[model samples]
Target: MASPAGQFHPWRHIITFLVITAALYALVFFTPGSTAPKLGIDLQGGTRVTLLAKTTNGTTPSRDSMNLARDIMERRVNGSGVAGAQVQIDGSNQLVITVPGQNNLEGLTRSAQLNIRPVVARWANPAFVAQAPVTTAPSTTGPAASPSATATGTSGAASTAPSSPATATAQNEATTPATGSSTVTTASSGQGLRGEAAALLPKAASTTDASTTTTASSPSSPPPTTPATATPTGTTGTAATPTAPATVEPPASVFPAGSNPGVLTQPAGSDEAAFTTWETAAKAYANGGGPTCAQIEYFQGLDVPDKPLLACDQNGQFVYLLAQTLIPGTQISDATSGFDTQGGHGWIINVTFKADGFKTWSSYTTAHYDRTGGTNPPPDSMTAFTLDSQVLSAPVINEPITTPGTQVSGSFTQQSAKSLADSLKFGALPLAFDRQESQQVSAELGFQYLKAGLIAGGIGLLLVVVYCLVYYRLLGLITILSLFLSGGLVYAVMVLLGRWIGLSLDMAGIAGLIIAIGITADSFVVYFERIKDEVREGRTFRSSVPRGWKRAKRTILSADAVSFLSAAILYLLAVGDVKGFAFTLGLSTILDLVVVFLVTHPLVALTSKADLFSHPVWSGLGNVARAGQEHRAVAARLQSKEA
Candidate 1:
């Protein structure tokens, strides 16, 4: 068998290419934004919210809605600064949002209702639209109802011009308060004001009010049918059925708008009318709507400008509007939630249930669905849920929802549900979170980590170089070159990932990159040692290259495979900064395999032809190691044959 002295000549191009690729990635990173890459939250600051999605309509939310929600949240996060934030969806409807704090926290919370709409000259929504709109004439609403309230439009902007009475009336329907007990205030009812088409549709069908009539004899109230049936996480389910999938024909264009984003299956006009009709009927289903389904429940954004709202409650279900979060001084730190408590999952906002809240909830539902037909429900049975707000599952309310401070179960995820409850229970925001996790972030901490990484990496490199020289002697240069090739490739990947995926080199990540150096060198070690072993066994350079490869490949594959598996497992399980470490570790492991196969082996094959192996001084290995039995016995035997 011949030695691998110069069997392959083309490998030089590959090593050069890898080095250049690494160089380009370094260029991409370390540049300014626009030209450079972005960082992650830990390196920056901001609020991160995890929302669990509950399909209000009994089906899973569509991919489009989920993506749109993520996009909208990102917009809200980025709107704070040119330093963009990230919003991504995990699982089905679960969203993870990260925004840089940049010293403004309330600004971040206000962006929470990213799903709210912006339409009409006024904040014309398909919501309550009721009450004596503080600007309008006095209704029988509580005295707290004022006529001089300012109203924000659907887009969350103050309307440019004052709306006409009819316009005000229309816009008022859409304006509801934040969804907290402390935030709920009184307003007049706005149910009967909707178009005739909406009223007629529900009249076409009727449900039994048997649940209400039998309440006196029933031992326990039946629970509402929640779309989320305690299903295990990661379980894929079938699609949902629309409550009132419109059978009506599409209008060509131009119809009275409702809350549903015109992005419907049919034309916007048809969807709009259907939503309006649905709104009217759904309102009836809530408490203000009818006795059987009077009250409707919803989570609202407090910043909506309108005041003393008259909501639409067409059915007999209880209707709720999210009041604003509690004010600071009004909250008590030691407060707790009780079943009798009207606020959050179990928080009391410390404020009394004001009269205004009563009028807003009860009046709307009473006006629409107070009348009962023996055990039979009225013709208009509403399918109650929020228009665009991230509605958890809205259960079918088969009975009148009456009681002060009752809990509205949206069947939300623990996080989102808690957030809604927290907003309601603790309405005040004295220390708005500009940052979810903040550190001193002095030059001391960053520099300390940086200096430590440099020291560790330097020590590692020094050891590899020293060991190579002590053993391989002339061949040590080749070992050093191979190390550089792998390092260059790893560096390139880090820079590219930072640009595309917001990766950072914290302490853990640096540790990962440093650890990879040994793994990479080990591959080269296996090959180098095998070559020396073969040479001593009497093989020539050409044959040893492939022969050495055959012996080394097994060890290389086994070692790399273990490293790759560890990285994959860590990446899946670890959260926060640890993920960065796992990612880098995994990436470097892959690159090491590539470098060993492509650069290290090829260079060795080419260098073998330079006559260094036959000479004592120029070979890439030391005198004692390379000068073993292969030098004396093999050279003597071959010389005799030649003679």
Candidate 2:
């Protein structure tokens, strides 16, 4: 340990380290929000998806299912190019995900309803034997009969039946809906409910007809025969003939439950136009057509009070679509989730309805099971059981349907099928979502804010530079050199902090740097002021330096410690951008001590021996200020002689 009069101080190294830290901070922070690196949503945008827990035979999707679902979803989200996306469970079954620097994303922000739906296709199987259909033709035995002769009351539409497979196919195509029926499949009067439902189906085209599949004739086989025999009555039916009666395309969906855009039109008698029209309407409606998306307006052109169509309900993410015989007072008894015992292998869903449901469903669907109906047009059959004007299933009610909670089955994938089952069991969402706000953000504006910050920083730098020149003169070089060291130190710290602990510098932090400039100057001022006071009292610069340092250390430590404490407290309590201010203030307060003791003191000690500082012109101190500062040894000698 050296005496108080000793020229060198042990605390000097700590000061040097602090100056280096400040310099590092300066370099890193000067880049707008990054003067130190600023963190953003882009670097870390979060993942969002809606989830629906099973309500019926759909068990509340098991915890394991939830976990597995989370894993699968996480994989999908992370795989989609977002790095560092974190997925976490929100509630018992909910999940939340986040990433960095993902500003203004156009992501589908709806709850995820993963499911496996069976691929449903129309097949004209032999009523006698269940056979897969190769084409749309309902291959029967002999004389091509009118469509009315086969299935009675088939959607209450009039048309001739095809006894030959080719003609049956043409009838299927003729029955398909046309125009905007997809959106407006139903009407209030229910005058021809089944006719409308039939209209929604695709005109099953036979290989023999050009109207069947949209392809040209390859003159190989004979053209398909459509019964031109006027059905006992009168009505013109357009039929498609195929050279080869084969199914080259999928049959139109019968009950393709989709959004209804509130308007749909049916072309007069074209199979192609009718099928295409239905497709358009079902896909356009969203959110159950309850209310319009803020971006899309709500427009309900058709609906009835007796049988109102319900969109996605309380649990909007889930939908309850039933193909049961319509029952007005059916009460639900029980419901459960499909089991995935082998870890998501085969899933099956179940639901049970009350006794009343069993009775109503039986009556509502089987009213026209075997009954033959009258058709004013050429040949007609009663149409039945359609949701959104699309046939879900059209098995002629051979017998009354009596079972409660009837099971619906077809080609379903694991996720889609399960999702549908859950929705049917859980029901719809209660409230509707209306977009309250929608706006686009610009990086350009962010850059402008950054520019304003830089300008302010430049002004602070100029002031610090000028003050040092006028007050310290040649000695002021210590301030300039110390600032350079501080800037480097601050830069390194910020980079490491951002990369490791997620520290960032914002506008507030920039302000802290500016304020820090003054704090550093204060430290130097304290030391220089003390030295001047000592010299005015007749002490030499050497003697005054040690005394000045001793006194300034306590004041600097006390002041800086307060600043550090305040910053720490603010950082702990503040949210968002405010923390940036606290972080910079704390960092700069610490570096202030570094410049004063390390660069300022050491340089002053070495400069005391130089002629430049000793000479009044370079030192900037007047005769009055320099006093005995130049030769304090003479005072010491005279005092000793006097003693």
RMSD of each: 21.4, 21.9
Separately for all candidates shown, the number of backbone clashes (residues 3 or more apart, or on different chains) is 89, 102
Give the runs in model 2 whose Cα sits over 4 Å from its true position.
Answer: 1-36, 39-444, 626-643
- How do the residues 1-643 of candidate 2 rate in per-residue lDDT, one tens digit apiece? 6567644853566565656566656656564234445443322223343444432222344567567655654443333221233456656645555434433322212122211111112211111011112222233334333333332221112223322221222211122222111110111111121221111122221111111111112223333343222111222233211112122321222223332323111112234444344334433321123111111111111222122222221101111221212442115454444543322223334446678765654555455433332111111122222322222323223234445543322223444444444444433221111122233322322656667877987788788878988887876887788776766656576576654444545566667777877777777777777766765667655566677777877887887888889988987786545666777788888767766666677777777767777666776655635565555667788889999
Which 10-residue window of candidate 1 scores lowest in summed lDDT?
A: 208-217
Q: Runs in model 1 with CA error above 4 Å?
A: 1-9, 12-16, 19-444, 612-614, 620-643
Global lDDT scores for all candidate models:
0.42, 0.42
Each model's TM-score?
A: 0.42, 0.37
Candidate number of the best lDDT: 1
Q: Which tens-of-lDDT digit does each residue in 1-643 have in candidate 1?
A: 7859765554565756666765676576555433422333444344555565544244566777777655555544443222335567778656666553332223334323211111101111222222112121112223322344332222111121111111121221212222221111111222221111111122211111101111111213222111111111232231111122123422422121232222211112234455455344334433222211111112122222221111212121112222111112122222112222222323221222334543443443444442332222332322222222222212122233243332333223333433443344333321111123322222224445567777999999999999988777767777898788778766666656554334555666777889988888888788888887777676666567778878898989999999999998998786555766787788889988877777777777776766865454656543434577657877899999999
Superposed by TM-score, candidate 2 places the C-alpha of residue 489 at a distance from the truth, in angstroms, of 1.2
